[model samples]
Structure formats: C-alpha cells, structure tokens
Target: MDYLQYAFFRNAVIGILIISVAAAMIGTYIITRRMVSITGGITHACFGGLGLGYYLGISPVFMAAVFAVTSSMGVEWIASRYRIREDSAIAVIWSLGMALGILFVFLTPGYVPELNGFLFGNILTIGTSDLWAFAAYTVVLVTFFALFRRTIIACAFDSDFAQVSGLPVRFINYAMTVLVAVCIVLTIRLVGIMLLLSMVTVPVLIAETWSRRFISIMLAAIVISIVSSLGGLLVATIIDVPCSAIIVLLQVALYFVARIGKDISLKRPIR
Candidate 1:
C-alpha cells in the first residue's frame, strides 16, 4: 500500500489496469478465434516500431503502433491469399521485424537503455503522460469493440459464413488486426514487449474453462487480470521482483488453481 503512495506508482497502477482491460477484452477474441500466435508475432514486431522510433526520435509507442498495424496487415494479406501457412508467415515476419529493429537500435546514438525496458517492461517507472496515453487508448479500443461486436463475433465464430453473408469479413479482419496492434502497443509501457503475451493469453485461458458465454468470459478475464495486477504489484514491492514477471507468475498460479478445481470436480467417486 505504501508503494501506491508514490505518484509514479499510482500512475503505473492505472497504466497496468488500462492494459489489463484492453488485453483481456481483445484477448478473448484472439484466443477463441485461434489467433494466439499472431498476438506474439505482433508483439515482437513492435520492436521494429521501437527501432523506427529511435531513428525518428519520436515516442516509441507511436512507432510501435504504426509498425504493429502495418505488420498485422501484411500478415493478414499473406495469410488470406498465399499458400503459406499462417504460422510460417508469422514466423517470417516476426524474424524480419526483429532483425530490422535490432539494426535500427544499433545504428542509433548510444546503446539504448530503454531497449531492455521495452523487452521486459518496467511498470514501476510509468509516468503521468503514460497513464493518460493508456487511458485514451483504452477508450478508443472499448469503443471499437462495442461498435463492432456483432461483426467481430460473426467473423470470429465463422469467417467463411460471415463472408457468404456479406459481413465485410476482410475489412473486419483488418480492423481486428488494428485493434490487436493497439493492444500490443498499449502494453509495451506496462508489461514490455517480451512478456506481453502472458497478459494477452493468461486471463483468456482461465476464463475459457470457467465461463461458457462470451460476456461471462470477458468479465471473468477482466476480473482475473485486475486481481493479478494487484497481486503482482504487491509481490514485486515486497520481494523486489520485476513487476512484469510477478504479474505473469500470479496469472500462472491462478491458471493452475482453475485447472486443479476442474480436475477435482471431474473426478469420480468409488461406487
């Protein structure tokens, strides 16, 4: 609780919550639609955005957002039309993006200290500006999701049928890609690029087994993520562990408990 007294700590907490809500909401669709790998791909590609930001000396978040969206679109275009497997295409793009990011960083003035921060995240270092940016982005994401719920649900459950019904499947897919890009970019400040995948996947994984309805899953995911965020902050504060790592650990523990509960409930007693 004392840790929360610091202004930056407070901002960090708010930033993390913003990230959790966005990740949880979009994560539901990502997991249900089997786009988990793409989440990672988009995350790694944000490194290229980091590099671009370094080169341009602008906010990395801005460059990351641009790179993530462009990369997602590129992956979508290739996956939609080419014979290449989605996984293969993702891997190819992921590698190329990272390579370019490294080149850009190395070419910059001095060794970038923020590079490592972007890799693993440094939530405790969040600033007021970051908090505001996160809040604004979250609003945009929520509005996007709310307005496109029907189309997204249809496409997620059945793309071929959505296309047959003239639901603008391709456009919706691209829009989802943009949302994911936003999600990835939003997270870099809170969880970093390397471990952002956990925030995107863990809550959704727990909710999937516990809830059957979409709204229920999303609500559960949000609750789980918020709890994990608080727990992670406490654990990191007391133990001096990295905030992002603690967050992932808390999510893992929750997943195990959920799994264990399921196993116990499914067990049969001797007759």
Candidate 2:
C-alpha cells in the first residue's frame, strides 16, 4: 500500500491504464472483425522490429514501430492483390517474419541481455522514455478511434453497407492494421511479444460480459486494465514477483469471474 504512493508505481498504473484502453478499443473491432489471427501474425512480425533494433544498436521501440507498420502494409498489399484466404497469408507472414527476426538477431553483434525483454517483457524496468512514448501513442490512438467511430461501427455491423455508403472499407482495414501495429510496438517492451495477446484480449473479454454498449465495454476494459496493472505492480514491489505475469494472472482471474457470472445469469429464471 505504501508503494502506491511512490512515483514509479503511479507511472506504471497510468501507463498500463492507457494500454488497456487502447488495446480494448482496437480489440473490440479485432474480435468482431475476425482479425485476431491477423493480429497474432503482426505480433510475431514485430520480432523483426526487435531484431532490427538489436542489429542497428538502436532503440527497440522505434525499430519495432517501423517493422510493424511495414509488415502490416505488406499484409494489406497481399490481401488486396490475391483472392487467397487471409489465414494462409497471415501464416506466411508469421513464420517468415519470426524466422527473419531470429536470423537478424543471431547475426547482430554483441550479447544483449535486453533482447529477452522483447519476448517476455521487462515491465518493472520501464523508464521515463517508455512512459512518454506510451502517452503519445495513446493520444494518437484515441484520436483516430474517435474520428472514425461511426465508420468503424458501420464496418463492424455490415461491411457491405459501409462500403455502399462510400466508406473505404479497405482503407479503414489498413488503418486498423496500423493501429494494432502501433500498439504492438508500444506494448512489446512492457508485456513482451509472447504475452501481448493476453493483455489485448483479456480486458475486452471481461468488458463484453459486463457492458451493453461499445463505449461502456471499452471504458470497463480500461478500468480493469488499470486495476490489474496497479495490483500487479503492488504485489511485485512487496513480494518481488514478476510484474507481467502478475498482471496477466489478475486479468485471467477477472475473466473467469465475469464468465461465471454470465453463466449464472443465463441459468437463473427470469420473471
């Protein structure tokens, strides 16, 4: 409890809250749009970005963003040009990107212990630069989401209708990819590439059970994310546990509780 008053804990809470909100908002569309698998492909591709950073001895964040955006664009290009199933395309990107990433890292000079952070994250070690970049990305994501709110709803509800109404479905889809890429880059350093999907999906799962409206669900997800972040950090500080695991565990617990409640409600008799 005492550590809650500390500046580092406070910043961790804020950063994670922003993460939850951003991921949940994008995740809603991701799940509804059946893009979860594609998102997974991009997550793996982000390893290329991490490898690029290591090879150039530069900031991983910047390198990750570049690789993510490029990979996302490549996916978009392929999906548009061929009449192939997205799953196959995603599979191709997933395997090749990861293989290339590993190759690049193997070729890079020197032994860098921090490389593991890309795979498993180093949440406790987040410094000022990470926090600032997170805040900037959060603002940008929120702004984009807000501006395209109606169109996104339309696309989610009925892509045919959205397209008929003159909304650029392909462009919006591309935008969504870019958004996910940005989040992937921002969060890989905090939650790692391996555990990133949990952070993105768990909060949204809880919110979907409890919320009636899209806005409410997104807001609820943000709150859940914040609570988990704080709880995880507090536990880590007090008992020296892994913060990322603690945070994810907390989300899993909340998800089960919400699922159980839903099941119970469905079984109850209504007047």
Candidate 3:
C-alpha cells in the first residue's frame, strides 16, 4: 500500500493503462488486416532510433517514434509502389534497423546505460513526461477511430472493395500504419521491444476467441490487457522479478485459459 504513494508507481499505472488502450485499439486493426508481422518489424526497427538517440545524446523514445513511423511508411511504399513483397520489405527494414542500432551503440563513446530497459522494459522508469506522451497518443487514436470507424473497417477487411467504394483506401492504410508505428514506440517503454509484439497480439488473440466483431475484440483486449498488466505489476513488485516478463507471462497464461474456455464452449451441447 505504501508503494501506491510513490509518484513513479502512479505514473507506471497511468502509462500502462494508456498503453493498453492504445495497443488494443491499434492491434485490432493489425489483427484484422493480418499485419502482425509488419507490426513486429516496425517495433524492431525502433531499436535503430534508440541506438541513434543514445549516440546523439537525444531522447531515445522520440527517435524511436521517428524510426518506427518511417520504417512503417517505407514498408508501405516499397511493397505497394516499388514492386517488393510486403514481407520482404519488412525483412529488409527489420535487419537494417537492427544493424544500424548495433553500429550506433558501438560507436557511442561511453557505455550505454538504460539500453536494457528499452530492450526488456522496466515500468518503474515511467515518468510523468512519458504518461503525457501516452495520453496524447491515446487521444489521437481514439479520435481517429471514432471519426472513421466505417472506412477504417472497410479498409481493414477489404482494401480493394473499400477503394472501389471511394473510401480512400490508400490514405487509410498509410494513416493506420503510422498509428501502428506510434503505438509500438509508445508502448515499448512498458514491455520493451523484445516483448512488445505480444502486448499487441496476445490480448487480441484471446479476445478473438470469443467475438468476431472488431469493436468487441478491441474492448475485450483492452480489459484483458489492463487486468494482466496491473496484476503482473503487483506480482512483480512482490516477487522482485522483471515486470515486463511477468506481464507477458501473465498474458500467455490468460491466452491458454481463454483458449481452453473457448474449446470447452465449442464442445458443449446446444440447449
């Protein structure tokens, strides 16, 4: 209970809630469009920005956001206009980003501190500034979804049909890709690059087992993420384990439970 009085703990809670909401909302689109691999590529690509930031003495999170957005848009351009396969583009960017990050970190004069935190996450490091940035992202994501739900849905399910229907499919695709990149960067501090993909994918998978509707999945994922994150935080604090790892483990455990429950329901006799 005394820990609740600490500002860092409060900030961590706020940051996780905001990240959970954003990741859930963006993850629904990623799952629906089958862009999980693309999202993973973007998340890894942010490491380049992190390393560069360390070398340049700037904020790594900001640089990570820049790298992620650029990588996402670059993938879109290369795949759509340059005649490269999407997966191929993701692979190129993923490798290049990691290589660049390694080079930059190696060149940095001093031993880079806090690199492990970005790699594996430490919720206790979250500060008020990070919370504000997350809040801003959440607002932008919610506003975008609220204003263009139908178009976004159409694009996610069938881009060709959406384009034929005059829904600006290309524009929606670019916008969502950028948003996905931003969400990845924002949440990296929570779960780190290594485990960030699961933060976006696992809850959505569990939610999908129960509902096919996009909004339902998003809401369910948000709830599941919040519960798991908070519960993991509590357990990690008590056990003195890595918070991010604990959170991911909790999410995996929930996924199995949800899967089992889903299977049991499917086997039950109809009334």
Would you estimate the TM-scores of all the predictions? 0.94, 0.93, 0.98
Query: On residues 78-162, what C-alpha lDDT tens digit does candidate 2 reach at each position?
Result: 8779967677888888887799889889999889688777788777566777788888888888898789888887787687889
Off by over 4 Å in 1: 268-271
Highest TM-score model number: 3
lDDT of each: 0.87, 0.81, 0.93
What is the total number of backbone clashes in candidate 3?
0
Q: Put the candidates in lDDT order, highest first.
A: 3, 1, 2
- For model 1 the TM-score comes to 0.94
Tens digits of lDDT, candidate 3, 132-201: 9999989999999999999999999998899988998888999999999999998888999999999999
C-alpha displacement of 87 in model 2, angstroms? 2.0
Error of 2 at 102 (Å): 1.1
lDDT of 1 by residue, 170-234 (tens): 98899888888887887887788878999989998999887777778988999999989988988
| lDDT over C-alpha atoms for residue 262 of model 2 | 94
For model 3, the superposed segments whose C-alpha errors exceed 4 Å read none
* Model 2: per-residue Cα lDDT at residue 98: 93
TM-score, cand. 3 = 0.98
